[model samples]
Target: DSFNAFMSLNERAARSALLDIQKALGPFRNERVLAATAVTDMAISSLQRRSVTIYLAPNITDMTVLRPLLTLFVQQVMDLLTREHNPDALPVYFLLDEFRQLKKMDEILNKLPYVAGYNIKMAFVVQDLKCIDEIYGETARHSLLGNCGLQLILGANDQVTAEYASRALGKRTIRYQSETRTLELFGRARRTRVEQIRERDLMMPQEVRQMREDKAILLVEGQRPILASKLRYHAIEPFKTAALASRQNTVPVPDVEMARALPVPATLPDYAVDGPDPRPGRIELDRHEVIDDAAFEASSAENVDAAVSSKERLVVTARKLKSVIAACLSAADMPMNQRISIQDVLAKTIPDPEEVGLD
Candidate 1:
């Protein structure tokens, strides 16, 4: 249920993020083309000497729109990089801090190899190993992490994560001193210090905790592992600074409020009522109060096939009617109990169309 909720939240975030971007880039010709091509175009331009930075708050919960928007953005960057006209001198960086917020980490990681040719680099930062597991699942997380040329492990607090990191970093041995007692003759005892060297896997809990708290794991080209000393502080600053700088050069887009304030037609012409209401006021129909004489005969039969068949048909029709009524009630925002009552009514009334005046 937590996983489901997380996914639903992520999807909502993604949708809102895309909407925000669309609002910012207002009135583009060929809207579909604009949506599809904006990221690629921007990436190409960025590669040709422009810098691009997209920033969002850490706690932004809407990911429904965010994932697709980032996917498109990354795809565009990849497309620009892989194209034959890609300039070798210019390099583009797609930096995502706290990357677990987005849902496309695995897809993006899988495509990273292809983007290398375009001189496009990706940097992803997250707080812990478990974040990756939670966001991408275990298999994809492993695959994605493995493909990175560089793995920078900062501090980690969890024992499992630290152990994994310790093994990755390799191990060393150290010597320890201990007190030893020796009895020479029956009456003489001697105490001496003994030094011994022991080997153990490097799984320092303190170091891992420090790394998680203070260090930033930098994975470059998806291979070389390094503990990035400066990244912990500076990872976010560069993007923030870049965004601030761009604000001075950017032209302000018109506010949507002004557009909303424009007068709207009171009614839609197509839906305007032009004649007196056609709802029927009176109906003349023969009501047949039929008694089931055959029912008694059918019930008495040893096989009881007809009775079973009738019951089955009623059950099937009731199910179908209930589904239809449920759908309508759901759309109308009717409470569950009310919806159930409507379903009951439909099940009983719709079994014979003539009763509802439909025959």
Candidate 2:
């Protein structure tokens, strides 16, 4: 009846046909939709462990599921951090690979700079600087990367990214000596030498684009940039064993107690469209096993030396930030408008150092 409504009532029916229950429910009858809507044993607290928990990207066919999962995860994490103080609420790290592919990614990143106090840390992987700017807008890109404690560039072939890296890396003072010579017709040649100092890019855009695949560039906040070899996990013992061996095979595994190892999410069974819908949480949520925490616990890393460096880091950060602001003020394309003010952004986001005790 719903499908033929356009034919039955022509112009009148076209506007309201899709609003009917029968037409709306048709989309939910698909197996993929059913699986997404069905109940599952998901506990936000269960994911708050001291070890790694990897979330693999969803298949292309199941892409719609990613948005809810990500949003739910964020909401639950915020609630867990504020609403209830669980004893086991340790630091939670979100390692977001293919970061731009996720839906509402800006929501996650917008909250990043302030969430450190809640023990929330995130690492986002991006391929092209222009793409991020295009996808999330230039201001957001600036905000997200500017506050990062570390910026690691594995590879950059695009000119936009190379230029961005070249700028972000700052400059170095280079000194060189120049020689001038003139030949005399009657006798010997006379020569003069002069020395001068000038500033140049530490890494030029061309050099950044030509960087080797095995190497990486790291820009640590307040410290000098580092060019180092990338870690080869495949060549490492436990990594190689885990990748090639079966689930039951534990060869070459680390000697640490099994309880201390990272917790892995269990695979959920695919639900059929024809089957009755089951309430979510019918299955048990995954949790960490009891372990001896003191055996591997390291002493508090925050000491007087780190406290002294905190001021220096903030100073370096503020200098770079001023440069960024200056560039914005000069650039015609910095995207300032009546509704949006960078001044307000900086004022709100740049928290009081005294409040955080970093001062």
Candidate 3:
């Protein structure tokens, strides 16, 4: 019933549905088939009570689709925690790694300042400040840093972030002393000492950039920044040896199996279909059809070049379309969660430009 409501629309309805605000769902969809499913607010409630949960990226896939999915999952869980838990409830720690990869979370991030009242804390691991600025813009970056009462500056590779860390740590007064001695009279030596107190950054920008991996600068509100060494996780009990063994125990999956299991779309994009035949002019339109070796070799280099160029252009067009869709979705007033299903359907509908001729 739901599948028919989604796929069995008139041409006008279908066209309008292309930009339908309802398609923006975050979770639960038929990616391998043409279908739709409803997502409820309680979908992520179970995660709210889970002690430990780790969300990892789908390996080797483009991150565009996964971004909204993860964001929705986190947002829904946070909402549940805020609604159900009291201040005395066990604290929830949201450990988000490479947080800049997700989109449409600025609203949730803005609300993070109040999450602590509900006994929920968040630790965002990012490569650099520039990542947030480039993705979420300057306002969000400021809001995030401003709300963080404690900031840790780790050994960084970028000069900008290093300088930021240096500035944020503020300056300290240092005493400098210079001593000089002269023995001109041969019998006695006179010494002169001059001391001066000057204010300078506790950690210079260059120093922050060159800081060792084991060391980091910790800045807490109303206190001077302190340099601290990091403790290796493996050095801790239970996590060290067990973690290493678990990492080593992972087995690799075959490429074919991995591709089949990946939740990608089943149909080709309309733009990628090569006319009615869906194949090159030389090939027959049957599933079991094959060309003779001699006939295959008879293809001229020009035809091959043309096919390759067409495929490349198709790829460029698909990327441009994705950009357009992202921009449209961002500018729309619809909810981020509601927009995800639409995005997923659009992703599946795109044709594989490389699927040409026979095999």
Candidate number with greatest lDDT:
3
Candidate 1 vs candidate 3, TM-score winner: 3
Q: In the order shown, what is each candidate's alpha-carbon RMSD?
A: 21.9, 34.9, 19.8
User: Any residue pairs clashing in model 3, and if so which?
Assistant: 23-342, 24-338, 24-339, 24-340, 25-338, 25-341, 268-351, 269-350, 269-351
lDDT of 3 by residue, 1-359 (tens): 86688689898987787766456643334452213123233344454455556556554464655556667767877777777655446667787877777655865776788988877778888989888888878887888888888887777788879888989878889999999998867679889999999999878999888888889889898897788988787898677988899899988876552212543332444424544523443433245777677666565444566677777777776786788677766768887765657656566545554443322
lDDT score, candidate 2, position 78: 59
Q: How do the candidates rank by TM-score, highest first?
A: 2, 3, 1
Q: What's the distance in Å from true for residue 233, model 1? A: 6.5
How does model 1 fare in lDDT?
0.61
Q: Could you tell me the TM-score of candidate 1?
A: 0.48
Q: Against the unseen true structure, what C-alpha lDDT does each candidate score?
A: 0.61, 0.68, 0.71
Candidate 1 local lDDT, 133-249, one digit each (tens): 886787877776666677776666687677767667656799999997888987698999989999875546556666545556554553545665554332578776777778768
Better of 1 and 2 by TM-score: 2
TM-score of each: 0.48, 0.56, 0.54
Query: Which candidate model has the greater lDDT, 2 or 3?
Result: 3
